[model samples]
Target chain A: MPNYPKGERRRAEILEAAFDAFGTVGYRNASMVQIAADCGVSRAGLLHHFPTKESLLEAVLKQRDRIDNEQFFAGGTSDDGLDYLTRMVRLVEHNAAHPGIVSLFAVLSSEASDPGHPAHVYFQERYARSRSWLRRAFRDLEQRGMLRPHVQPDGLDVEFLSLLDGLQVQWLLQPDAVDMPARVRAFLSRVLTEVA
Target chain B: MPNYPKGERRRAEILEAAFDAFGTVGYRNASMVQIAADCGVSRAGLLHHFPTKESLLEAVLKQRDRIDNEQFFAGGTSDDGLDYLTRMVRLVEHNAAHPGIVSLFAVLSSEASDPGHPAHVYFQERYARSRSWLRRAFRDLEQRGMLRPHVQPDGLDVEFLSLLDGLQVQWLLQPDAVDMPARVRAFLSRVLTEVA
Candidate 1:
């Protein structure tokens, strides 16, 4: 009734613009008016799609997660430990190719570390979900005797996640000095034998 | 010339206030006027000391680095690898107790990842210096055969720093769930046969 397809396309464009804005200057510093201008939409039109900056931020984060899932879990969440680690390497490789995506998460994740931040709960839940899945993968590795003798699965999930998150900042700051996929592979090999 | 000691005291107070503000709202969002107000200093007075926000940021970073060096290198930079690692653990323990300090770094280091950010060059040089020193430490360990058989010195410096930096975000987001020092110790123990 209201040109639904055109509306959807416009909405997608707004999301893309907001993602770049948020990634570049971060959410607090990013302006709605500027974002609207970036996407060639009026302020009212931008607000029509995203009622508030918070809503836009939410949409961008959701889009990011959706892309990550679609890319890595296309086969419906691999249960094999090796498959999971291999996918993680691919994900890091994918991230290296897209500095904007890495910058978005790196910026927002730290910015949202404040308890009062709008995305605080979002990041907390995201990390919890990541840790849970990683724990399952580590358990699978333990079952197959792939984890090294010194490798403890108890806090390994958080450590591994930290490694990935940490590597991103270094890679972003000094791209030539850090090879994200290589470092991730090195970490995985250190903890687990026969890393694929 | 005019109340030099008092001027120094006020500068210190301003630094403390800016550190807290920067940690809470990040550098881009932190307002100079608000920081001046927090320290009960007039805008002119604040400007008199720092001249610009960038200058204040530089001073705060220098203060942080000075504190770290004083606490860790009282003996003029330990040459022993075990002592260096032990000091690192102590540093992490110290950081866990100081959430504000950790927050300041976690927020700024990522925020400054943007090439145009004021502290961009500072963070780049800081990481370079850290990697160089860490590389030396690893080399010392390799020479003494303290590093495990599987441990490769190459890229280990960046990986270690990444683990530390990455762990800060998780710890800040969910402090109760993350034991920073413990996770650091675990990573160290995994790589080295004996961790002090």
Candidate 2:
């Protein structure tokens, strides 16, 4: 059904190897040689599939995004924002397990905002979309009497999103101490408890 | 009373200029030449006091620690943990005014965890010290009955710290959308009324 079937599989294989390499060793330290060795392929073959380190890094980040969305959102169960908290905890748990991925996101997100950085546009778009979705979810919670009447509708979204972003930084810093999912759960539980 | 009056002044001036430069241009992009120009000094003169860019960056971060301590906990108000929220808001507001400084810290902090990174040890120590201080403060709040009787004693510190760190990431990403101080204030208000 596909032209260049072997090529596609080869590309996917190389990308997987690179992901593992970068996740463990980090973006700066992970090299083409290491990736090729991990894949049991020649260095030239690895480059033939993905020509440059930047290209490989971008591929890994892109793959991560799709995987992350699938893992967290999973496309259903959007009755209230409670799922968001549970999903957030699951995300943190995943990050804790794959500390390398956490490290990659932390190292790159800041530079990604630079406009010229490789992942600049990707990070910006991801952030914008994520923020919009989060705000919409909070608004739904408010409408469904899931939030306090005193919670300013105009400002509620920002509070939720800020707490979410803030906790990620902390979790990345000390995964052993900061259970991101649990903290979100507590805050969300409080939100529900305070609702009108 | 101090020796090298002019030298001290020049060094201070350079650090200030460099701070502004790094904040605006980022650590990687802001060059010593531009920093020298910003301070009305020759590039070599700028280097005479601080030999390397890394050293200058370290000085800037150290300056931030000094300023943060002075403004946030002046007269050692951290004696009670509740007041820390007010200081935290103040810190957030200060950062909003200087987005570059926000970027600087966010950028360095991300790198600060990598053992081989220049600022790694500094950040690691900072996290340890900060966690200890916050844990004691939360414990004090519990002792004063500022928190509910059943509130988990040790975990609140991690939660509070996570909130602080997580909020900053959101603030930087969508500065227009996030009223950091107000968001933090709301979180504190909720925590005080509900848990405290």
Candidate 2 chain B has its poorest 10 consecutive residues by lDDT at B187-196
Q: Where does model 2 sit among the CAPRI classes?
A: acceptable
Per-prediction DockQ comes to 0.83, 0.34
lDDT of 2 by residue, A18-55 (tens): 77665433455567887888777888888897889999
What does candidate 1 score on TM?
0.96
lDDT of 1 at B26: 91
All candidates: interface RMSD: 0.8, 3.8
Top model number, TM-score? 1
Question: What interface root-mean-square deviation (Å) does model 1 yield?
Answer: 0.8
TM value for model 2: 0.78
Candidate 1 off by > 4 Å: A1-4, B1-4
